[model samples]
Target: MKFAIFGVGGTGGVIGGYLANAGNDVTFLARGAHLKAMQEKGLTIHTNHRGDIHIEPCKAVSADDYHETPDVLFICVKYYSLEAAIELTRRIAGPDTLVIPILNVFGTGAVMQEKLPDKTVLDGCIYVFAKRSGPGVIEQPQEILRVFYGFRPGQDSRLAEKAAELEKIMRAADIHAHFTDDIQRDALTKFSFVSPMGAACLYFGVTSEAFQENKEVRETFIGLVKEVEALGHAMGVTFDRDLVATDLRLMDAFAPGLTTSMQRDVAAGGPSEFSGLVSRIVTLGKKYHVPTPLYKKIDDWCKAHGLA
Candidate 1:
């Protein structure tokens, strides 16, 4: 499959490098220092699970010049950057191209559908954590990587079949992909879990280490999770009520030094994704008449701390 990944920062780099290494025709749409780095030295994937792996000579080009129409396109930019990302995706669209947004923003699929009516648009929710450890180097947490996606509402079976094909392609690349019957619910459920985790940890100074030892902070974490859960329910999205417990279990499996990427951004004095993560939660709360005072408080703290 010919795959093009836009916004190859962390998540995109990990998946794109892995797929390209597996011999899929992969082209990364990149810009600035990252593109220059990948052109000079191919992307590297370093994993504690798989050891140091390098994908030298992986294909990369600036989005403006990537004219090859891809079978699969992964839009992995931050929600705040969605406008530019979609414009770039538009440049490579063919009638049969499938554009799958890996970002969790609720309305992005609709936006893509509006922009590319002829192309198949889908939504994906990924449960892997990765970061650009350095230029052209993607560092992944030592945990299972899961990609779940499906067609949008009222879409045809062709989209599902195409998603399954992409899933097979992913498995061929030694990556895991799960096809879900209800992708919107899957996306919202994930956002319900992630938005709060990123907000509380990034805003309230709750490091992963503290998330382990601090009882009150952990309970607060659960509170924010439940808050999002309630808001999701109000919005007619079904998420596991036991998600808190599941998150607790998942936490144990993560590296002790692991932190939310948003938290990492805060520490690095970079822009944090509070709008898509937390601010969107606030928007949903208002739309559904759900009160998210705790989330709001934490979000305000994030703003004060220069994290928002």
Candidate 2:
């Protein structure tokens, strides 16, 4: 199947590189040094489990250079670039195209579905420790490359069939892709980890290792998770698993010195998903009348420090 990736950063580059190297028709829409590098040097993936891969003679085009629609489109940009990403997808995606935004933020499927009403937008979130170490060079430090996605239960259409096809394609490339109707619950469960950890990590200017080393940091992280979990419960999302324990397990499993994308962006003074990951929780809490003192404290710090 034909695939087009909107943003070839950590998430997009890995998936696109894997698919393209597996001999699939994949085009990457990217910009800057990364695009140039992919055009000239090919997209290189330095991975842990499956070893290294180099997709030479790859297909990569800037937004200005791409115009063809594909069987599937992956929205892999940071949450801050959702507007521009959505507009670009609108231009290239057809009605039958399956668009999956495997971003870090929660509620991305709803946002994309609302914006691109004519297209099929699947809710998705990834579990991986990946980053762009250099231009066109993505490094997956861990083997956690799982893609969770699907339509809500009983949302009629061909999405279930399409999702199964997409899952096969992803798994064929050695990527773990799971389809589920309870995407909201899964996304919120993921939010309980990413958003809260990101907020606390960015606020303290630390990484995952910090949570293991410092008592105060661990407490703050756990508090943030509980706040988000409370908000999710208030919103009628049932999370039977021990959310905090899961987060701690993942946190401890993360590589030493591991930091979230938001923390990295803040450190670099670059654009991030501050509003989506940090602010959205507070907004949801208010909407559901769930007090989020911990999130509120982190939000206050972000606002005061100009991190937001």
Candidate 3:
């Protein structure tokens, strides 16, 4: 498939790098020094288990410079940049294009689909510990890379075949990709881990190790997960596993000193996904009549600390 990674940062960089390294036709949408570096020296991914991957002579360009429509476009930008991604999609997405957003925020693809009603936007999530260490360089601290994507329940299935094909392509590139039948549950399952981790880490100004050792921090994480799971149930999602236990296992597996992108962005005093990962839970709690006291407490703390 002709693929376009619309935000060639950590997440997009890993996916694009692996696909391109597998001899797939991939275009990367990036900017500033990252774009310049990729245009000059190409993209590079540093992995712990798989060694390093180099995609020289890559197609890296800003959204404005990219004009070709892709068979699949992964919108991997931060939730705050969704508008820009939507605009870019509007400009380049063709009739047969499949748009999947593997963002930290839950329900991102559905929100994008509302903006581009004519396009096929599927909900998706990714599990990977990756970050851009430098311009045109992506670092995968661990080998855990998983991707899930599919049409939401009751949505159109005209492009299901393409989604399945894309899944095969991604798996061939060594991505643990799944074309899920229940994206709502699967996405909420992923969200059940990320939202709580981000909330607790940002609230306590700690990292993964803190959650592993501190009882208070760990309980707070568990509480947040339960709240999300409750909200998921309220929204008619039938989860197949115990979210708390599942999230706890994931939490324990995370490398020590690891932090979420939201934590890093806030620490850098830049735009973060606080609204999406933290505040969104509180909002949904009210919307669904689900009690999210832990999230509400953290959201209040964020507001008081000017991190909201």
lDDT of each: 0.78, 0.87, 0.92
Model 3 TM-score (2 dp): 0.99
Ranking by TM-score: 3, 2, 1
Please, what are the lDDT tens digits per residue for candidate 3 over residues 1-308?
A: 89999898789999999999989999999999999999999999999898999999999988899999999999999999999999999999998999999999999999999999999999999998999999999999888899999999788989899999998999999999999999989999999998899899899999899988999999888888889999999999999999999889888988898888998898899999999999998998899899989988999989998997
Segments of candidate 3 deviating more than 4 angstroms: none
Per-residue lDDT of model 2, residues 34-143, tens digit only:
99999999999998778889998989999878989888889999998898889988898897888889899998878888888888888888887888999989998888
- TM-score winner between candidates 1 and 2: 2
Worst 10 residues of 1 by lDDT: 249-258
Point out where model 1 deviates above 4 Å.
none
Error of 2 at 17 (Å): 1.6
Instruction: Give lDDT: candidate 3, residue 295.
Output: 89
- Residue-level lDDT tens digits of model 1 in 1-308: 79999988777987898898888899998888888889999998778788877888878999888889888899988777888877876777776777888875665777777877767778887877788877788887675777878887788557566777888889888788877888877877677666766876776666566666788777777888788778878867776457788777666566666678777776888666778888777777899999988888887877786668
TM-score of candidate 1 versus the correct structure, residues matched by position: 0.93
Clashing pairs in 1: none
